[model samples]
Target: MKTKLSLFFIAIISYSCSVNQNKTKQSDLPIIGTWELISATTKEKDSTFSTFNPKLKMIKIINPTHFSFFQHDLTMGKGPNPTFAAGAGKYTLVNDTYTEYLEYFIHREWENNKFEFKISIQNDTLTQQGVEKVEKLGVDRIITERYKRVKN
Candidate 1:
């Protein structure tokens, strides 16, 4: 009986450690690089997807526990003075959910908002999708962005 109880305890401890290791390993696998935004799409209420051809180019960089994303329009003063449209903050990735806490943004109202996205990676492509409700934009929709991993 003593030997059986010891074996059971060892199995339990080992299983618990493996679970934690998996979480850590999985989080360390993807999203640790600079990604350039390839495309952005929004899904309407009727289940139709509309692509937003952004005037600015967007780039995102993710570290272990922090991330920064920024966009700059290269157009030389065509509309609204093509300039900076960027934000950055800390991020947490658990399982496949990516949550970003806005620490800095051009619009003050956007700061401190917790933005969550469902993330996936394949080969050199990264995809993120999430439903966003922006009262200022007067629209609530699902946004999906595809990014290509930038070669360092």
Candidate 2:
């Protein structure tokens, strides 16, 4: 009887430990969801500047190997109108880093761009810092931007 009781207690403790482990693993997953822009820093000509906007926002949907980013300028208006004026792209995340291969449409022209960077999340704040390379006027220029998560 004592042996049976010891085995039962061990089983209970093993089950509880497994449940806690699963929760920890889930929490370690990347922060992949709708996020907003809190601030940004642009590196240009050996100088960096803070570019945080109170009206700019973004959302990201991350799947296993691919993710999508949606950015919008909210200074224009509120509600659905702001979301309508947005840009989107697809990307891939390896480990804790992400690379975006974005095709943007503007002024009746489509432009291809690439962004590579590392990402981190602390509570509701998600930060992404990366370099973006784009062709402008037949020349390639590299720009860096950092984003912070806001809300759903």
Candidate 3:
């Protein structure tokens, strides 16, 4: 009877430890890192179009209350090498949703544009939806993009 009771208690302790370990591992969301754009679609003036050879990357630094967005795109080039478009901004997360505020710099064409959007991060996928207005072009565009985490 004594040996049986000892074995039962040992099994219960081992099960409790395994459950806690699994919960800790599951709580860690894989969103902190670099993500490459798989696709992007935009709607403007009742017309929908997609970007071709659209190579874009975004780096996100996760924080307790907010985060940062570092975005860059590979510009289509006719020459030997491709150019890049880069920008940086900050964001806030509420209820597992994020809103990014972008400030353009590296790409002169987007210097005067401001962007605001909500983002959803799930496992290795990140999705963003937002409206962007370009003062120079006098156009309002709706943007939706999906990114997959690039393995380090």
Q: CA lDDT of each candidate?
A: 0.83, 0.60, 0.64
Question: Alpha carbon lDDT of residue 83, candidate 3?
Answer: 55
A best-first ranking of the candidates according to their TM-score comes to 1, 3, 2
Q: Considering every candidate listed, which one attains the maximal lDDT?
A: 1
Task: Point out the worst 10-residue segment of candidate 2 by lDDT.
Answer: 137-146
- How do the residues 32-121 of candidate 3 rate in per-residue lDDT, one tens digit apiece? 566767778899888998863545455555444334445555454544555555565555544444555555457567654446766777
Q: Is candidate 1 or candidate 3 better by lDDT?
A: 1
Q: Write the per-residue lDDT of candidate 1 for residues 64-146, one digit (tens) a residue.
A: 87889888876855777767777889988888888889899898777877778999999999999997766776667889999
TM-score of each: 0.73, 0.57, 0.58
lDDT score, residue 37, model 1?
93
Instruction: Give me candidate 2's TM-score against the actual structure.
Output: 0.57
Candidate 1 deviant stretches above 4 angstroms: 1-28, 47-51, 76-80, 135-139
Collision pairs in model 3: none
Candidate 1 vs candidate 3, TM-score winner: 1
Prediction 2 global C-alpha lDDT: 0.60
Lowest lDDT sum, 10 consecutive residues, model 1, at 21-30
